[model samples]
Target chain A: MADEDATDEPQGPRTTTAEIVPLRLPPVADEEPEPLEDPRTGDVDEWGRSERVRALVRKAYDPMYRNWFRAEWDGLDKIPTEGGALLVANHAGAIPSDAPTIMHGVETELERPVYGLADHFFKSAPVVGTLWSRTGGVVAHPDNAYRLLHDQNQLVLVFPEGSKGPGKTYNERYRLRRFGRGGFVEIAMRAGVPIIPIAVVGAEESMPILFKVPSVARALGAPYFPVTANMALGPLGALIHFPAKFKLRVLDPVTFPDVEPDQPRYSRSRIMDESEAIRQQIQEALFDMLRQRRSVWFG
Target chain B: MGRRVLVTGLSTFWGGRVAQALEADPDVDVIIGLDTREPTVKLERTEYVRSDENYSILSRIVKATGVDTIAHTFLVVDSTTMSSRAMHEINVIGTMNLFAAASAAGSTVRKVVVKSAALVYGSSPKDPYWFRETDRRVAPARTRVERSLLEVESYVRDFARDNPHVVLSLLRFCNVVGPDITTPLTRALRLPLVPKVAGYDPRFQLVHEDDVVAALLFAIDREVPGIYNVAGDGQIPWSEVMTIAGKRGIPMPPFGIGLATDPLQRLGLVDFAPEVIDLLKYGRGIDNRAFKDAGFAYEHTSAGAVEAFVQAMRLRDTVGSDEVDYRYEEDVETFFRHSPAVVRDTPPS
Candidate 1:
């Protein structure tokens, strides 16, 4: 292996295993630092620094990068303590910002941290791409979801309303986006966890979506919002961050009975119907709480 | 010329007083009071039993005292908003036990007169028509207690139909008020700013104890069977009743006190039970034309009953205070249950 790298940057020859072997090790100071804790288990003694550095970078982007938009949480106690949780909240706000707010809610009120499924755009930016890997925020794919929850014992938070959530016009603010698919319910059923209904009141007003940009979507190779309509021509997106008081009421957890880990998962249709019911319950509770002006805002 | 009579539920307000009155009568040779409780009041010719073995007790009493005739004024009212199962145990099962025991004894038990509430006349406020024995069966409004009352009525009717020999008399009473009364009426009277909800316009006709007692005696004398409306002869509005109570120095509260907790009086919990809410929302102010036509005379008017209650309050020094007087504490429990079936069976600690 040492004899293979006769020159730097290997002349126009097919790469051999020996040539690549020398490039693997680096000076101690140049190496990326170890993660303070594992993203999955938070264990330090097992994994290498490169893996830890990736996790650290992801962790750093969460608060700072996400804080670029205003968010709030209320009644975070509804998250369960030990088992995997399926958090179903109303999806609104451009780029579906309620996800981070929900993560913060569970993390702050509950001792456990939540793993959010970020859209494909976060990975499109190289810096954001690295951050996603280290922080454990995946590509928000449907197939990887069930495995993430069932195996990891982490709280799975999803808007369920998808892209239609944040793109809802101002007239539809506070009204929830339609829950198109029910895969979240199936994941919860398979994992045998309680579905926690969360009502996010302030997200819609944060970065209101006026219109979708098909051109920007093509350029970025993403199907969802290219630029928040509030940000399209400018100042409105900044104005939208008016520190709106947000109330998140964690409703009583709805648990599906008799689903064992070894048993077959629930059908997509049944899960979808159950999820819609859970969402409706949250919406009704939110309307009642908000109409009563009984929000428990942090600020 | 001696008349023998057997009475069950004599520890109840109506039955207890009736038992006391019957035992005092010189013409009544044997007065056997069958109760689930040990008979506390003593009478010269009266024997008491604390068990519901009505037939066995009646047979034993008749064998001892040569009782030739039996008359019962057994009544059980569901005063709490418990589950139907609990209500059935106390009201249905308990009544069934009494009736079974009485039947097995083959004593001269001839007639059983029950005291029932006129609230069964359908708790609807618009019950402007006078309720008769033949009136349609009013579906029990939502309160579990009211439903329980209806269940008790059903049992009585069913038992009466099954036993052709045993005569059954049902005395349906309206708001029976007297001084020292802790009824829902009295409680509402004490509320400050009580709401007369749009649909709940209570035109209450409160019966006096004297009149109610008179009606019971009337039933005993005539051996009246079937149902009869027994109450005072006035259609007094709930507001007017409150005014009368206020004039008598009873606090006419302007609002409902039971919706929130009243610290000094834990009694509100019992008063505001869901059953009572059903009674409040829909109970009709009953007509007492049946008893009146049966030659049953009412000595005390509705106003007189209110006056007597206020006077009793003054005598007990509970005229204005909401606190329970030690002497009347047992009465409150008896009055709340409206049943000798409850108090007679349990020993007072």
Candidate 2:
């Protein structure tokens, strides 16, 4: 029996070749054209269930935590119902409470399980880390991202401006930062999905940072502490939070073509082009909205 | 095989000067000059191609000439001199035509050198310290001619990249002066009386025509391609130019016109052509570190150019000739009318 096992293992050593010959694979036939939907999408009503969770969460928290803050939404209905989607929003708050609001809005309003990025929050904390990893709260890795979208039919949200938006304090609020060359466009194209640009007004003002307490933030591994409203002086730090009326404005979803039938799924150029188009549309919309917005201060 | 070199707009005053410089270089085997009118400066080897508009001639001339290096020196301070369509057609489309021609011809061309102006820096009290190749143009330019230079510069750079071998060199010059320059500054410096003191005393830098000639020639000789500030070393107050003219036996400009008339003209109290207005208000200057680094040696100064022009005017008996034809006023009129928007607020990418 041992001799038979040895015979099955092959008795010769592998030989190395001096001349490298390029090998080509035989083409495979196209069988399944579309990707399989996640079981989550099947059992949970993606459009309705996600929003229900958001409403429940927001209702539970807002009165106690955000009495002064309001969520303003634009073009909320244009979110695509079936396929994978991309949501790009401006990042503002230091801790980036805006991401949570955005996630909540999409899940509650659009009714989809929204996966987004968290800087340090998900990276630490063992249980929350496991939850994030399972639920597809990507730590901003664009590659693992492809896998998440392909495997999960999930709505991926990105703050393309990254640190630029969130790091801006109250003194410099609402000023749009430079958009990085459109990578989100490429992702949508790869996933054969559409992009929904969500612009949130009043987020910048809510956490109005009077000045950056850089030493405190850096020591704590955070970007900066924005001294907002009553948070400047002693004792009243927790109670000084101001109620700034907030509005989250979502623009129309921008769609891109799927990877070409015979072409590779990941085409960088196609992705960049799609991203640029979406970015331009969002920028124009935001600029126009800002111009027409009646409420400057959330009052 | 010998290479073909195209020089467009070789009929204008500075263009004629450049054509003469190109004639001196033996490496330039075949020459093609594209101009609306036949070139007044005749070259034995140059093939003169006449088109009513620059756009019509660009592609065909490039194809026929098989030009590998296109040296552009087209100047039209006013777009209205040409039809509005013609202004864009000549300046923007004409450049695109060249780019298209280069792309279409698929020649072994290695470089394209375009002469742009430093005026695109706009009026600055010197926060830029010196306008580097990347310094943003701050002020909004008044005329279309000022604005088109930026557009043309960008388009040319993009075009050059389309053909990797076709690299671009943008030479931003600050008032090129040579023996041949009949510009109002040269002419004004040569005038007797009132010219003794240059009005406003703005720090000015001028590139000698010889230096400009050498720079253009170097663009062909060397393969180095990038934007550069081209000017002489001496930053002279306009007064120095008048001083040099004075020593050369030219009469100083009438002092009255600068103090009274210049201010009145600028203030709209007195009537003056746009050219005269431009001349009176020409403040701000460029930093020439890049030109110096590029190994350009200026053989003349703004003062020297003034001396040369004064000498020429004297030789032609045009200085103090009693009849100030004021054809420059017409030139200014034509420039405003024909030139496209000159300065763009956005910095070049």
Best by lDDT: 2
Give a tens-digit lDDT track for model 2, residues A117-222. Answer: 5443343333444334333355564443454465456778888877768677676777667667666666666666667888776666555666677888777655
Model 2 alpha-carbon drift over 4 Å, by segment: A1-299, B77-88, B126-129, B191-199, B247-282, B318-349
The true-structure Cα RMSD of candidate 2 reads: 25.4
Q: Model 2 chain A: which ten-residue window has the lowest total lDDT? A: A17-26
Residue-wise lDDT of candidate 1 within B160-248, one digit each (tens)? Answer: 88776766778887777775335666556555554443323234567777667656655665546788988765444444454555532
DockQ of structure 2: 0.01
TM-score of chain B of each: 0.73, 0.74
Per-residue accuracy of model 1 over A1-299 as CA lDDT, tens digit each: 54323321212212222222121211122343333211122221110113354445447535543454334455566677877777788877765556656665566457465666655555334344434433445446544455456655667777777777776776677776667677777767777677888887777666676666777767766655534545654765533443445667788888878666545555666777787898788779868866865542332
Q: In candidate 1, which residue ranges exceed 4 Å CA deviation?
A: A1-299, B40-44, B52-74, B81-87, B105-107, B125-128, B180-182, B187-200, B247-270, B318-349
Model 1 residue B211 CA deviation in Å: 1.4
User: Can you give the TM-score per candidate against the true fold?
Assistant: 0.43, 0.44
